[model samples]
Target: MIRGIRGATTADRDDEKEILLSTESLLKEMILHNNISAENVASVFISATHDITSVFPAKALRGFEEWKYVPVMCMQELDVPHGLSRCIRVMIHYNTSTHQSDIKHIYMKNAVSLRPDLKK
Candidate 1:
């Protein structure tokens, strides 16, 4: 079976280092909470708000030793009115037997407001 684990976080600023670090932190939390391994990840899709243009959030995944070969893509989030700013979101497609309701969706930093219901 296949499932998608979703996560989102906000960077302190638009700096490259901040973006990279923030993304890495969010991914780490997602992986830890879901007990996910790069080997089981089919793909990852990341998106950043228009205000965040310092670097591609997907670049953070390469920092994980086992995630270097994982397929990943990056894109800009739709600039919807009143949308969250400096936000990075990720959706990881994984090969797992876990039921949908059992999957953990992570929301951190200011992005917590984006999905208050999913906040742990």
Candidate 2:
């Protein structure tokens, strides 16, 4: 079965380094939470709020060879009236045997406020 795992995080600043580090941290958490290995990932979709133009969050994942074949695409989130700034959100699709509700979704830093209903 193909399941989607979601994760989001915010960078302290729009600097490339900050974006990369924050995203890498967020992805790592999601990977750990879901007990996901690179081979299980089908693809990852990343969206960053308009303010985060310094770097592509997907590049952060490429730093590790594990993600080399894990097709990733990064896009800009729509600008909303009160949307959070400098945020990076990811949805990872994986072919897994786990049930949908069993998947762990991660939200960290300032992005946590976006989904107060989820387990942080």
Candidate 3:
């Protein structure tokens, strides 16, 4: 079955390094907690707040050699009023046997407020 794992995190600033590092960290944590492999991943969709225009968050995936085959895309998050800033969100679609309810969605940094109930 194809499952979508959600994760979000905030960068310290709109710097390229900050965006790339934070994205990598969040992706690592999500994969670690869920025991997911790049091979099973179908694709990844990343969206960043308007304030973050330094670079594309999907660029971070290039650091992972095994993820070379993983199709990834990047876009700007909707500019909702009072929405989180400097935030990057990711949705990873992959083949998995795990039930949707059991998937561990990761929220870090200022994004913890986005889903207080999932905070841990």
Candidate 4:
């Protein structure tokens, strides 16, 4: 079965370095929490708030050679009133036997406020 894992993290700024680091940090945490391997990931959808224009979060995802075969897409999040800024959100679809309730969704840094229920 295909399961979806969600994760979000806030970047210090729109700078490339900060965005890249923030994205990588979030991905690492999600991978660790969910006990997931890149080979099992079918695709990843990443979106960043409009404030984040320095770089595409998917660029950071590609930093790992393991993602060479993974289908990853990046998009700009709709700017909603009072939405978190400089936030990168990702939904990873993977084939796994784990139940949806067993999937660990990660929310780190200021992005934790976005998903209080999933916050660690």
Summarize candidate 1's per-residue lDDT along 56-91 as a digit string, tens digits. 888888889889889999999999999998999999
TM-score of 3: 0.97
Query: Clashing pairs in model 4?
Result: none
Task: Residues 19-117, candidate 4: write the lDDT tens digits.
Answer: 999999999888898888889999999999999988898888888887789999999889999999899999999899999888999998998898798
Q: Each model's TM-score, in the order given?
A: 0.97, 0.96, 0.97, 0.96
Cα distance off (Å), candidate 2, residue 91: 0.5
Q: State the C-alpha lDDT per candidate.
A: 0.93, 0.92, 0.95, 0.91
Candidate 1 — what's its lDDT?
A: 0.93
Ranking by TM-score: 3, 1, 2, 4
Q: Write the per-residue lDDT of candidate 3 for residues 1-120, one digit (tens) a residue.
A: 999999999999999999999999999999999998999999999999999999999999889999999999999999999999999999999899999889999999999999988765
Worst 10 residues of 3 by lDDT: 111-120
Tens-digit lDDT track for model 2 on 1-120?
889999999999999999999999999999998999899889999999999888899999999887898899999999999999898999999989998888889999998898888774
Looking at candidate 4, the ten consecutive residues that score lowest on lDDT are: 111-120
Q: Which stretches of candidate 1 lie over 4 Å from their true place?
A: none
Scored against the true structure, residue 8 in model 1 reaches a CA lDDT of: 96
